[model samples]
Target: MKRFIALIFALSLFPLSAHACGADTDCALGDRTYRIQMPDTAGDKPAALIFAHGYKGSARGTMRNKSLAALAERLGVALVAPDAIMDDWSIPNAPGQSTSPDVDEIAYFDALKEALISKHNIDPDRIVVAGFSAGGMMVWNLLCARPDDYAGFIPIAGTFWAPEPTSCDTPAANIIHIHGTSDTIVPLTGRPIAETHQGDVNKTVAMYIANGGYSASDSPDMTPDLSCESWRSEQEATMTKCLHDGGHSFKADHIKAAWKTLMSGN
Candidate 1:
């Protein structure tokens, strides 16, 4: 009788098992909601990957892409997809447009990271950031704002919006720029807005080169694959520019290749 009582007391003192939270319409951040998908496997600490959607896109937008989820599962990593505050993403305005300034996207990422850490046993060193289109721009900003928080970044169909007198205070984070040469929305040569134009792939690559201290003459030959395209970074830093043949759409093959590269460091 005493042993039974002691067993009951011991069980009461222990905490219950906590599971990874799934997509709940009730879970919201600012004016937006999130759809977080974690691996079903149970463990004390798991690597995590946070995904941001493009303009006018929801968490579901990226979640529907089975390839991303599959990669996360294979890697035993958690996947968190958060919605942007507004339907539009916060990107740099034209060269001299003073009326509209870039939104505080870094804050959103910080908040989301805090929430994830509080809820899960995530490995801080293995965190990865990935996004599409406008979301890609957000990823680039996050890399620049908080380079140490993430292991790497994967930006698709988006360029780094260069601020006037470009000043990136953070260190160079591993980056993979996946773009489409035929992208009409955010063209490789940049799109012409009212008076000024936004930065393009060339400008983005240049910024990375300048900030990352890479040699200009070391442009490697393009590696052409059936599903995607790739260019190796000249510097020792792990960076690459992948230009595919399709338009502004997410390709599963491209994502898979990117995932392999990201997880290879592990």
Candidate 2:
């Protein structure tokens, strides 16, 4: 009996099982699911950087990028990559794509964020959301839907559909939009996505500038293969338009720029 009691006490002290998730897994939230990565410091409630992958892309795929993984570790940020319903994010009223009313992408995001906050003690004010391509459009949609939810945003290679918001629902968060000048998939001048037209990048920037109280001045900044023109609003939201020789892709330099802007609080 004494030996059994000692064994039980030892087992209790070092539990036989651990329930924390691995580097990546499908975490179910009510009727939705998200692919999450809890950092080594997750128990300490580290800041989160949630990423929405491009249309038809998986969260694991994005996490597999060595640079992104290293960035998460280097910055001490918890990385949460949520999978979209129907294999793609449902942007509001976007053509050629599932709409949020049907897929409830917004609800999924809400659930995911709440879960992270409750379970991992995430800092609400430190959360940022970023995306690429179709996912980038969803980032803009998220800003429109829940303007105050995130600390910042990075939308790459995508923009809102026509009739973009002239005003934000809430005060601005830091925003950095990265686009390739040679992107034919979603042109800077905008094009028909499917049945509707995505708005011009300049118009989107203009509206943000007006609403964000930014002066209409762009300064030059050069990257390895891209020339960038950057503008900042009084609210600290920034727009960095990069003219790259490539198309419809997120480069390592773009990630670096986005991270720099995010860390700088602009």
TM-score of each: 0.76, 0.82
- N/CA/C clash count, model 1: 0
Quote the positional error of residue 166 for candidate 2 in Å. 3.0
Cα shift from native, residue 116, model 1 (Å)? 1.3
lDDT accuracy of residue 212 in candidate 1 = 67
Could you tell me which residue pairs clash in candidate 1? none
RMSD of each: 7.1, 4.9
* Residue-level lDDT tens digits of model 1 in 136-179: 87777777778668878888887665332264545566777788
Model 2 accuracy (lDDT, Cα) = 0.73
lDDT of each structure?
0.67, 0.73
Report the C-alpha lDDT of model 2 over 1-266, residue by residue, as the tens digit: 99999988887885221343434656666766666666776556688888888878887787787777777776778778878767677765577646646576777788888988997688887888888888788888887677678877878888887877777665665677788888888889888766888778888877876776766445434457767666676665665666677789886566666666666654
